[model samples]
Target: MSVRARTAIGAVIGATLLAVLPGCGGGTSTGDSGGNSHPKTLTYWASNQGASLEDDKAKLTPELQAFEKQTGITVKLEVVPWSDLLNRILGATSSGQGPDVLNIGNTWSASLQTTGALLPFDDQTFAKIGGKGRFQESALASTGASGKTPTAVPLYSLAYGLYYNKKMFADAGISKPPATWDELVQDGRRLTTGGRYGLAVEGANVSENVHHAFVFAKQHGADFFDASGNPTFTSPGAVEGVKQYVDFIARDKIAAAGNAEYDQNQSIQDFATGKAAMLLWQAAGPNLQKHGMKPDQYGVAPVPVQSGTPGPGQNIDSMVAGINMAVFKNSQNLDGALKFVQFMTSDAEQKKLNGAYGSIPPVKTAAQDPAFSNPELTVLRNTIATSAAPLPQVPKESQFEELVGGAIKDLLADAAAGRPVTTQSVQQRLAKAQQQM
Candidate 1:
């Protein structure tokens, strides 16, 4: 899926689907008496993950066929593009007409769950899927509001990493990738020369900007919110993190001048075309080949942390990010939907699907396949086990993305215009961002 499409899934939070669409009461399924015992047909809305909807269908058709054969159920699969999934879902959920099961970005789970538009995977419901213990603890934790039964279950898992061009590193005489932020800046300076840049940044994408800020801020011992779920964008640690990110272009001059307009795809293209040495991204493997970049030209590493800055925070990483699957509350075939969810989560299916998507399976055992133990995926595996966290599990996450993300975009714009971006100025922007929330 496109990065914007994936990130936009989380943007639906704080918007009222029920209020906007008339008489939308979820969790009101038809009381079909023979639900569990009989065979049924189900409708499923799957998000696009490959080159196109056709590619996604190619990967999933066989699996769905297998599911039908095994359970005596038929699944009508609809591959929804990321651009239209959220809106389609909103319209469906609000109007009481939607698919029985669907795929959503993991970050959107908490907010969507709050609407009661999806059925909660409580103890009993989980029994229909798999036991709760079948999932990774961190992955499972991201599926609902705090202290509530999750409305979804994890399907695929992913994490952020630094992707650096090996040839560029060799050209720059750097033998190793950076492990700390200071080293990154120093190496970035070395790699930057002539028409090439050291790092590729997605300054124009508000979602990408906020995700980067999330990573850097976490490394500096700050979070987007506090215990009470209030915005803390202007916090000392957050300010420092944002400054460091903006400094790549504003202060250090290692990033390209035109990067202020780059989105995630542009940055990825820059790295793929050898115009930039490094890019921070999640799941670039599938897209790399599509962009005509050879795998051997680049290598992946854990994103650098503020290791030199000793304190309570130093080596944190990104959220245990990935795709999640949920069954809607209003379905004619709720039993069939539940079975389909379980079929998707089964060990065999997890391995098959994740392998095809180049994603980690949320099931612990399924993730243990040799396919995921490669140099590229192993680092992500370790990161997920040790450092990953979900985006702030708050209802206002969409608002947070807009507010904090827009603030950073504004900073980048000012920097691109050769205007000053002082710490005090950043603080002011953040203050304004928080006010917008």
Candidate 2:
């Protein structure tokens, strides 16, 4: 997914009661024709995955050209920014007019699947794109609601990791990276001096807020949803978990107060500029490269845990983060769209695209590249494989991002304003968020 990124949402779209929705294609369907005649063109909405909108367009042109050359189908691509993506998809669902294929944040899969607007990637549909076996298992976990057909196919796979400036660590006389939260706070004190903070955070960024909240909540042994799938946002564990994250600036002071206003990747920029000694991000290699930070200047490690080394249960460190490709059920060029999906997910494209973006490929075969063994990427891979967990996949999960994430934003702002953030206050804010849900 740095600069792989989130937020929550309340259900905004109601399933349209019109013509019956199309079915997933048959076992041998070669891009089933949606209209009277086979289609020749497709409109694709690609998520912004590169340095900028223009950059993503430039990076994807070659792949699009190649796909066109072999398949005789033209793809019209629109690189949409993250801020507008979910709303745009919701708009498409309500209007029934949108691009044939689109990239969705993997976390939105379940919520969007409920709209009945996107085509379900059933067994047969997955076969069209080299089978479900081609993708990583962890990457597949957040595709849709549990125990149902996946609504999308994993595209770029990612997991969060702690990225620390080597020079800062060495300068501070700190040896190894922190393995626990206590050590991190201790090291942070040493690193925070001379106008630089020990850590960086994206406070106003709701998506990232929800992400860290989810990770912290997991570490506190809290789940946003109960066993029966009801939201339990104000639970004691949930409140404590969320408060711990805000405390980076609120109480710990490891991050600067100004960080409370940062969104739009400023936290990443702060780390790259040496204004912050460390960063927690998903596949930040590309973002750092954009800022001209050399690979050797920093080292990657698993995010610090509350207690012991990262593992399952309360030790989980990061949420599975990445993009997924979903075909719109109402596409006029269903066959062409499927072909594009196949072209994009093919082993070659997976390697080329993921390499350019500095992300892990969801396709298993594509990950065998020797390049993935780089020290920075190796840490990310291990975290994703062993410690990363997915956020709740319920329909209201997006709403949680909106409500609770916004609450954190306010809390951080309050901290920046020198207001006291007590446990009672944190619980009150969380209770308000739960009431909204």
Candidate 3:
């Protein structure tokens, strides 16, 4: 099942909601093994995608089998869909029956850390993953806790950029991909005709939808959080950025109708089916492959800059999107779990996994490997090099998503209905949401 369908089902099956808490016992043996001389078995939970979890298991299974042959440690792998991951982890953590190791969405690191269920990646742990210097600086920051310690190790990294269908651009009489904000808006207007939208963006849920808003805010010199991790979305730049987003649907009529009901899947489907000409989305190479598009059929570019911005270079904010691996604090097989994380993030393994799965490696050296041959991947790599920033790792991160996403959704709905979508109204709504945070 898709993540959205599973999330809808999970919401309906409310009885399965898992309770979250802080802390777990340091030394507990849930897996029938005694003290940690050598664990007989270890459990791993992986998030689902086409062949992602399965491919990782397939590639690593040999190593695992070799480890078993060499050291007598058996690894058990469970594939969990994204929707069920939090619930499963929460339930297991609460019952003291969680998997020994799990892959988590990078943004969830801080929230998951609040449960105190994760083992900290101290200096000793860093050495296991080829040292702290192996991973990208932003990826490292995404895994660490604010005012605390690093809670997880970034397993892979992804960033957002402008993806345009070459055919669509040609059909619209556009010569090249947009590089500046005005050009983007003008192209969007030109592309919106004959049942095709100019862009596909998240509009429904806060979690995914806020990604574009965050990027636009960055272009205008506003961020969701300041250096000290306080909410800072009330600035003029932020308001202008958000207003441009809302105006795409409301004023420009360059987005699909009922966008407020859209999510990642819907947006992706729209783009894939040629109903949209452009998409500002996180790395979707895997999805594009599944949809039968060749790399040559599309063009990827850095997000366009805001017009008249005073920055020395183009302002583009790209969200750090990927999964991280965290060992449960209570696991009896901490050493084994840590070893597995180390193996996964190793330069060799990173190249293998990312090459197979169409994801960028979290480790810097692996990303430069010849195996990652796509030009789009190169664009993404360059975007990360210059403009990538970690999402808010605050414990209240989810709340921020809800606030920003909700406000945007309301503004779009109002604008689509030919109602007012003023800067003051958006500012007020955001201010109220900030206060709640």
Candidate 4:
């Protein structure tokens, strides 16, 4: 089937069959009741991660109390696992039993927008959340529908970076992380020896693999889409970029063996256990804390640039990613749902929530807050401020990853097996995949 036809069919199925929950219309309101005197309660869904869901509930207890004292509306919060969140939301929305507010991965924005399950935030609502000027422009851009107004608000932001062990660098007599692509390769070679791999890239997880690959493609002056939003993966720059990453693991043999099966967990474990010297990852703070590695033990820096790149000192391509907040279209308390979304994205709330979780604030002012303290976080914040780029917002983005990403993996396997990976073959494979997408 044609890509558009497939996308259309998927949207129809998603919207028509997914379960959606009903919102509370008449209940003992404990928070801001707004102008209307009708009592109401708001249902919220959050992902369970660091800071126990129970603790998140506890943290919000005070805020809920204050909100209730002021407005008399009660907030009911439920924590969902990351694995089940998307499916649950999809089912809930289709069944008309969805929550008033829910969290979603930033990349899922376009897909969710297509379901028509979310309500767009107008200018007035934007103002309530600290206005357009408050958020990182790229993040806000990622929240909107391709040809329409924004469907959700960016709740938090994060970007991928090179995290290295301080002791490993020092032991190798390397005083600093690489500033250029060539230097990174040299460092990787030097670090790879005696049962330790030089780097851990998410080579197996197609979604993550493509995310980092796009960062490299950007540094090489290529993008997944052209000015008209058509797929552009056949570009010479993109092909070269993909080769560079594949070569690191295959030709150079500097990445962990069996990397083809490595997911985010494998990469994280390799880095945390010192089996790998460096990892390109997003928001490693929580994981580091869990592993007992403090700031002083690790160093964070932007991904290095190729030797000859245009427009910058080091052509850093910050891979930005995060979750957005959305309210279902069938929601009974539309105004109340919007208000809750507004509260979550508000500058004050962004600061509090991001601070609690070590996430980069989505808002410009919140990102600049002095209280946002963490050495690694500071590096990430600075990188996002000057170099971040959004992923392709195409509705078929997920499908493209599955298709082209599989081709890249095949190329990697070929190269690792000492088989030639020709540019012509790569181009043919990618072109075919583009047609499929």
Candidate 5:
């Protein structure tokens, strides 16, 4: 997650929305028939969390087997790529043919809540899994719009960090990680020698672009939406924020020009292979290690700020990143689905699954496990608790990501092709996006 992303719902929002949330009334319940009888098998569409779909399946199979042994409920799993997850979920919502349970990017929680396709975690529903207090407040905050019942609860928690190759720094005589953007650019220059770049970015990844854009916007004191939920894409702060990020590739020249075409984890690959020195990513350590980059090879730090150390106020660094679990409102086996959710979020499962995936458990007890004591998890957990912010919970947030992120993607392309990326150019792109909204 990066609350992440690879999500949108503009065309899908009112497209045959089904049953409303629990306690909201006037819609179908989750059970197809008898509430007391449970299904023999449950379908789960898990988001791609490991090196590959096959890898995710391999990791989850044992857990699923254990679950079936204990509860007699077999889970049929499908690992969905980020590119297809949102549209797949939309198809389910529209056709009422979704899995019994699914993993959703936390960023989609509020937007998906509008469709009424998910079972709301209301008071009684919260009690079914555990208490509302069982999960961290930081992870819980992104579950849905404020003042509304959450449509889902956090399963795996993540936060962004500046992943730097430690050997590259030590060899370059850089003593510590940069604490501010200027220092980042400065350090980047020294490290950008001999064919390696200072930074790596997922320029074509819409969710990745939007996540970084959100962080920079916070540093510049820009909110993408007003209190009344109107889009504010071209505000001065917003333009500057977007520019600050694009400038890393454009003005700062820290990243490669070819990076503008990278949408997948190519940027991560670049960092892991030492083609780049720094990476701003969400819980990327395990993925890097999969590429043969060792824990001793790199270090994680809070994403840099404007001009000071990362903290509260303008220094807020990353967005709350993670996956959320949701049960389809019209699922055939509502009881089994709820049980599966309980099993997945249980303290034991949380520790096992989150530890394996290099994610911090949203469950407080699970996060406190010794497995999370490593430097990587420590930085991420602290960031989530102290510095990370959630994206706006507005219904149009996904649309905002699509439009603004696309605009930035184009801006990066232009910069990569030797075009100017001035404030005027940035605002023009955002203004067009605002009009689209």
Candidate 6:
């Protein structure tokens, strides 16, 4: 899932891939494996989703223990902090020493798969876990390069929504949330009074900025990569999409001048503290509660579609987002590792794990449980299936993120500093960014 912490994909691109380890017990498998030759211990690296590592361990250890009892394979669990997880993964990938099974942010799948370090999940391997039909199609499609065998499987699912402050809407004499891009800007203007802004945007956090750029681009009928998997940031539709995003601060003046420095967490804070009327984010309910905002004070809605865009409004929101699990190719216990993956993606475990993290499970049946059937989660779950798109699946996805994200960051800084943000200027910046890639 998209966490509050900033992710570093650059490190992975810079590191060299590790050579395959020899003498590994499990090379490849058919539908299923004969039991391991002897009792085996599996090391698992989990991401920290709770307030602390202790809290995450508290929620996950019981599940791990249950897996051990059911399968007779011991699990060594390590809860890695988000700040350190990427570096650790890169380090392990280079050293050929890492956990048998690990959690990775879905956005990093393509980049990590490029290293030839992860075990690919082919048809037979997928059957070992469960039928591929059990997963949400879009979520499954997000596991790796399109048309190739995926290196991971969706564990938890998440999507972006427009979060609006109900009280602010009422006070501003607005009755409902915006349904189109124009309405969103107009509503933002109406809400801009006193010290509060109509909207909040994360300008400093490159990853967050790039995500918004992707949603807006899709809304305008643009894809970041062509059929041949080449970068297309300079496309007319893509430029228009990003221009509209930057206009929130430059032309509309509904966002604060200093929002250029805000990250996802800061934008969340702005909305929670009533400094902004609306915010675009993904599954921010848990964070809202932590920031002292009551559930009743806010509402969630699908992100507004661009005016005059064709087709239904299902494809104009955030990417089908969340974390996925991958098995290391260099692990000495590939059979046991695959079994652990099966155990983790089981209906029972998906429900338990996603429920603890406040995300929807990837399994359709597990996602349908009453626990996630609430209105808030239902909106995002539907978005994931119908509206969400995957980040570009190129091996150089990290480079795309860095180059595009940096350009947007520069644009935001210029706008925040009261500099010009004309369409021509935006296109020029984007063109420069494309060249860098």
Residue by residue across 1-437, what tens digits does model 3's lDDT show?
A: 11121121123112322255567622244355456754777787777644355655676667667657755668777778665676676666566777888877777677667778888888877887678888888788788566678889887777777889999999888999887767888899899888888987667656555766877787777878877778887888778888888888877778876766775467777787788889876666667756776667778887777764222233765777777888888888877777778777878778876766667897988888977657778877777677777678877565576677677877877876778888898898778867866
| Model 1: colliding residue pairs | 319-389
Candidate 6 off by > 4 Å: 1-5, 11-39, 308-315
Winner of 4 and 5 under lDDT? 5
Comparing candidate 1 with candidate 4, which one achieves the higher TM-score? 1
lDDT of 6 by residue, 1-437 (tens): 35444543353443333332332222222112443433368888888776568988999999999988988888888898776777677666665667778988788788778767788899889998987888888788779988789989998888888899999999999999998888998999999999999998888777787888988888778877898888899898889888889989988999998888875378888999999999988788887888999989999988778764223343567777788999987666778888999988999999998887778888888988999977678878877877788888777776677788878889989999999998898889889978876
Candidate 2 — which residues are off by over 4 angstroms? 1-3, 6-38
Best by lDDT: 5
Minimal lDDT window, size 10, model 5: 20-29
What is the lDDT for 57 in model 4?
Answer: 72
Comparison by lDDT, 1 against 2, better one: 2
Note the residue pairs that clash in candidate 3. Answer: none
Please, what is the whole-model Cα lDDT of each candidate in the order they appear?
0.79, 0.83, 0.72, 0.68, 0.85, 0.80
**Pairs in steric clash, model 5:** none
The CA lDDT at 193 in model 4 is: 90
lDDT of 2 by residue, 207-261 (tens): 7888988999899999889977788988888899888988889889999999988
Evaluated against the true structure, the overall lDDT of model 2 is: 0.83
Lowest lDDT 10-mer window, candidate 3?
Answer: 1-10
Please give each candidate's TM-score.
0.91, 0.94, 0.87, 0.83, 0.94, 0.90
**Model 4 over residues 1-437: C-alpha lDDT tens digits?**
00000011122223333333333222122234343343367777776544355766766667666666655667777777554566666666555556767776676676566566677667876776557677787687678556677777887787767899889999999999887778888898999999998888666566666776787788778877887768988898778777777777767777865776664366777888888898877777677766767768788887677764322322656666777777765555667776676677667877887777667788777777887756778777766667776677766564566676677777777766667767777777778877876
Ranking by lDDT: 5, 2, 6, 1, 3, 4
Considering TM-score, which of the candidate structures 1 and 2 is the better prediction for this target? Answer: 2
Model 5 vs truth, CA RMSD: 3.0
Give one digit per residue, the lDDT tens place, for model 5 in 52-128. 77988999999999999999887888888877787777767765666889998888888788877789899999999
